[model samples]
Target: MTGTPDAPVADVRPVVRRHHGDEFIDDYEWLRDVEDPDVLALLEAENGYTEARTAHLADLRETIFGEIKARTRETDLSVPVRHGDWWYFSRTVEGLSYAIRSRCPATPGDWTPPAVEAGIEAPGEHVLLDSNVLAEGHEFFALGAFSLTDDDTLLAYSTDLTGDERYTIRFKDLRTGEELADEIPGTSGGATWSAGGTHVFYSTVDDAWRPHRVWRHRLGTPVADDVLVHEETDERFFTGIGRTQSEKFLVIGASSKITSESRLLPADDPEGEFRVVLPRSTGVEYSVEHAVVGGDDVLLLLHNDGAPDFELVAVDLEPVLTSPLASARDGRVVVAADPGMRLEDVDVFARHLFVSYRRAALTRLGVLDIEATGFGPMREVPFEEELFSCGLGANAEWDQPLIRIGVGSFVTPSSVLDLDPDTFETHLRKQAEVLGGYDPADYVQHRTWATAEDGTLVPVSVVARADTPQDGTAPALLYGYGAYEISIDPGMSVARLSLLDRGFVFAVAHVRGGGEMGRAWYDDGKMAQKRNSFTDFVAAAHHLVAEGWTSHERLVAEGGSAGGLLMGAVANLAPDAFRGVLAAVPFVDALTTILDPSMPLTVIEWDEWGDPLHDADVYAYMKSYSPYENVQERPYPAILAVTSLQDTRVSVVEPAKWVARIRATTTGDAPILLKTEMHAGHGGVSGRYDSWRERAFELAWIIDTAAGAPASTS
Candidate 1:
């Protein structure tokens, strides 16, 4: 069952693709308004809807797991290993039956893969069946990197088994591997170890699932009655858990939204009042995002005080620790030193602390020194940027254990290395077999700007050929997610090579509603000014055409989620701007989207997208440009709109409903196809290859539509 093919570009041009203006009002039958405000309200208040959705997700999870397990049966892969000591999920590969190893020791480069060769008579992978998931779901069992205490008595971990934007917290004892304490706490999980190792402070969603405070938990105590070290009552002020030396630091912010925040709270006493580390009311002075808590008065803060590139600042913790480290991850949050290194994943370890920076793409580990050192100037530790994924392990096997670094780039298979802070030594443990096939350097990057209709300049970053042809017609795919202050910076994608290899130019429009340019840029691109984003995308397309990099006939615009709204609005306003419109899980009906807050995330997302239901004025603003309701009879460009039936964030019904309307109203026969993933959430598809293959599907469609290539194997 291959996917549907894209319409050829050659067939699209000379078709007179142009913007639809008010002059076309008398051209065809206008859309009949059948929308019912009362019905939408009823659908939300009905709890039956939530139950049905939950049941549907469970079924989808089962189907996906069954399909994957069945396909890989007899593959001799090791059952995933859970390392409770230094919280990590690992799989070791020997000859056949790849052994899975987790919770590596704090000893540098001394990690032993699960094997009899470790010469230790202890419970290991061979001794433990991969039956962790065999029993009923362990709501507490977290996936990915985690940590344990020195005696392996207490364990801390996270579980996003379902990425509903929140991870549940679970504390267990390795001696029994039975969960000791579990807390959903109606919030996203952020567990951090306290200095005494008896209690853990973690961040979570509040009663309404809004980010509110960081709570504390005893090692084996009941999940009830968790202490609140720090709580932010302000709807705008949000808090989550991060790691300190012993306890989790309360990461405070203005909004839980990405790249948003102003302060942090590191509580030394999880059960006690928290002292503000970074002032939350710093107001507009600083735009603080994510932070890392280290020793004494040391803290690693990521902030853009209205600057181009975010500047990393080190703050003394003693002055900031008026309170305890309130945020939580595992048993203990390790701080990092400046000269330290991350293997490649999301972990950081150095001399004294293990640090984790959540917002920025690049992270570094630094040694901590309180008063003697004047921020020794934050230095970058060298690690292979390309072939490796580095991460840190907190609540590891030791009290002051060194960071366990996993290093290996594309050329190199995954390798384990322990980094020692005091000794400045990196020890090599084990390396996965070569099994060579892929290589890096097949990609490149370029940056440029385009001016919009209102004279607003939009920046675009392109990743394509160093030797792109001057033929001025290389098929290009321009992507942007320009809503809600999210910054789409330069990122590496392995699958992007699919289009690049086939000679397609990949570009990212750094439009408004995104922090690419700064706060002003974000402010200008949001709310009533959102039109700038759509026009910004269009201007970029026109810029490409004018620059001869790619013509409007050869250009295609793509965006997903909120960005999907951007794509649709642009396509709606300028049908002839691009060859194809690729939108995924889009919130096309913006005004209605915010108005129906009960519709999944409508209530929670009111701050991002204003609530139209609350005010008639807002509704009027929304009706001014609701994509679905605005779809009129016109010779629009070919479009591929995708959604997921299982998506709780943006329901399949939104895109489904939009596609039906678009198909019904368009003047031309341009295909308006709907591709829904029945098994995924806001994020489409799971498993790596599945994601790449899906991208391939979209790429094939875009190519055929924009370059006029043969349609995909529909």
Candidate 2:
């Protein structure tokens, strides 16, 4: 043995990829020969993931079993303690399924999920919302809405939670509690009545997830009206512009973008051909927003003029509806958020036009309560965070006015409140609970800025116990969401209370590509700028260490799906930054997954992460960080990667291959385990108890690894 003071000689066993050092090429060729990656090798890998996940679950199950007992302590907890991809399942009481509880939080008193004797299986004894759950146990939730008629005589509803975003409308008579076939396409939403419920108008989506023509349901027929009100496809404008929550205005873009003529049609003329609205300019890009007013008042349409810019312009329906439809380009100003960042949507209710920026970010909720000039000074309802989305008028009740506010904070549970606009006071309507005696005050909240590699500032929110020691080595776990314009905000969770009680510093990294700072922030951090997001997360980890928030040896990082990819990539980029990494249903093999169209969510996300195969630029950039293909025989954090076998979204094979590769390639003995569920979809678990058991398993891993035990003995 060479007596080298610097290097302590030790027998090193390489991991992850040593065996397949040269076999990958030949195996890969065979895979290409059949053009089917569902090979025997892959199958074996899948089994590996199952075994690892099973053992890990067993570990977690053991640790959390005692913790799962219902706490008799009256500890009031607020917001979510942990974060994960989830679903809305039924909680039954006695034998009745009372209300629909989403994986989302309850808005205080207004939407408290009914108490259920069935525990999490079915819930009951309160107001019920007829929304679709993940019934088939898939990754998708169906589209449905519940509305009570003015007289409460009829309960109008639609029941298509998944097949199409379009709903199928039906009515139930309260008197008999029977179904009434108020047959409607259920696609064109907002089934409002015409004065005396003569007809109900609605909109629905087509096969491609695009909004189709508007349809009206007459009081008599079991079928929708033969005549279409408006076919979004024929509007001489693209229909899949945006969602109801985010899209604001539609601008007939440049000729190159549209390729055809642009048009505007009157609402009354269902059979009318498209009326040219503006000349199609080659390569033009614009957006439009329309607000429909009641009865005699004309509809207000807003258009953005400058390229990548926004200018509020209005079109009066009274004049445009009568005269061949006026060009949408012809309008007056209402409001504008920016020119570069596209405006997402506008909500117009009695005397208020709430404008939203970046779909819904630091939402201004600018209420232009003006008939003419000079709307009131914009009321800045602060908290104004990116992780949470705030909306108005979820319910029309006077007691919870100030406009009904629906708010969700990262780590905080979702809640809806009634606010008196005049008083700006918030009154709780409904809220979500895990039924445990835990108080939010038991945790501390703090915000700090971390400097990225390029010196850019990233904000982080940390929550921990009040008496947390500044010992710099607490088992701190940091989470992040840095892609697809999603904000990681407040949410409530039952799984995290135990973690908090044990002194875990739960933090969220509000990195780039999120609407946290408005459009600019998101635009700057996505696609080509995607590297910034990964680095930003790394910086947040470094900041935690540097500030004694959590040190390098004790810091753990966790992320799911896209965030999981973030955690995986950052782990590869900086192995020493964390002690353990938990990636749930992560897109670790980004490039390969995106290149395949068969994957669930890929086809729908081409716009977000550009198609890789056809575009070499996207391929190269994605390859720059995809964790799976980039595996190296280097040291890595003890990793607990999870995925579901039945997951129709992110295929289970992803984690399978990733774990094997990492296990074989990495040098250190630190365990890199995969947990795959055999009978679940993207969520991995069916019931609350099952989910708690899985969560407890993860916490157990954290406890064992962070506390210095065999990483994965089982």
Candidate 3:
């Protein structure tokens, strides 16, 4: 901490990659071979150097971590969700790093959940899985598939101890409290139990880490005896298996970025042959949900066949079973597509239907009563907050008259409630306990628009302390993720309060690549329009400064994964627009990663990003904006790149190579630091405390950098 520490110098072995009649030289490509001893040594050295550089901010990190912990209720229980004869819930004890899954008996006529509180259990509570116990002796732990049989007597759960997505499935007899001998390994972290409780359906990943095969495992059979029920031959499509809410049909679905296909088999006949609900069509994506409309069984389809924003249609189940090539478009139109609304999902219960969609740049939910004729009028759920996130919760029972909904905003704590089908009245279940005299009134959230260079207005959600002055003096953080049609909705975070309390304005830029507005927004930001995502982020930053929210010196940019690519591009395009950049598990070397078909997710990503390997224009376009390739000899902002060595999504070598090139090429005095979690995956360090500490470290760096103080010097 006394003097500036020398940055770790990467050994460069230039490798020339020729694609589409173009040759590009890449240094540090050898780092991609993570098994190489030299690569591991380099990563270790980088971590050591980063630790030395940020040594002075250790106390600040602790203070922020303490603030996060103090605000969050350490011991709490989630609202129990009633499935069948039991109300299932999870509990976290004080100082515990994991949650304990437990359930209690449910009364036949009583729809009300038992009054369960933290550090307490309901009557006849039976523990199903305690992740803390299973996670012992591991640096990382994640609970994957937690499913119960229709009879509620058998349980199938999966666990990942190394932070990787692959899980090992296990079974238990809830009635006898005995752990069964059945265990399935190397699965894709999901499992669906057969209605009769005799078999479980799960998916396994291929060498590329894609869930490509669906397997059915009998409870008493060996792992090797599991049947490969379905295999997705296309590399672009991933397969998933699950049961309908009615528990009447088991569904195996396969989908790519733009197209999807589903096959259904009756749950009563686990050994029966699966029939196609709809054939896969090019550029058409649809999902099927089994529903009983007026006592007649039907398949409700949410599809984007000709509708850009998607629409809802209902087809008789018998017709889909009889005709394999039946198109959802030929069925009865339940809800016509609206250009402004992007239909996401539909869940049907015995007497009602829940539809989740995004309209006016916000997620909304609507409920419709299932009348004998057809369906009742749609009743949209109302919320007072102008900017908030709301979605469906655990509504496992088809006959359950209540629907659970999770709602929250940047200033509001997360609240879970149950909506009654009879009157659309919502009953409060539980709101997150934020200790230390926290008040939502103390903070304010604003929805503003930033005009991009093309005159397109991009939405930005800003949250700050109510008393904070907006005179370009307060340090601000601009966050963005503009890829994969993922929406960065407004959700409250306890850790984020540390920044707001410290006079930092947090703004999320809803760029084009995201599905914040609609499907058109995402389409305009991906593939050929990918550059729009980065430019929109830069525009948002300029708007914040112009609007007197924060100055360039007091502003910091943050993003992860694909958003990390945005950070890198903006750094090159508008280096003076921000004070610092934090890229976590970034995809900086986009051209390199996507050009290689052998890379994990490379082929699958072609739908989002054009296949540069096969197309000349795509290669040229990606090369033009590839962050690693575009590094120039110019002043740059302070940068902190975080990655996980075990991450199968974005390889650790990307950020490693990016940091190496930036440090070598930049003329700026700012430090470019790299931190790699050796024992974790893309999620970084697992466990609540460790995750908090990791966040604390990043927040401290952001605070220091925004103050124009370099935490590290190189």
TM-score versus the correct structure, for each prediction: 0.67, 0.70, 0.98
User: Which one is best on TM-score?
Assistant: 3
Q: Spell out the clash pairs found in candidate 3.
A: none
Ordering by TM-score:
3, 2, 1
Question: Model 2, range 296-387, lDDT digits (tens) per residue?
Answer: 34444334444243445556644543454334455555564354344555555445556555333234445565444433444555554445
Candidate lDDT scores, in order, read 0.53, 0.56, 0.90
Residue-level lDDT of model 1, residues 171-207, one tens digit each, is 6666676765465544465566655577776676654
TM-score of 1: 0.67
Q: Count the backbone clashes (under 3 Å) in each candidate.
A: 69, 83, 0
Using lDDT, give the best candidate's number.
Answer: 3
* Model 3 regions lying over 4 Å from their true place: 708-714
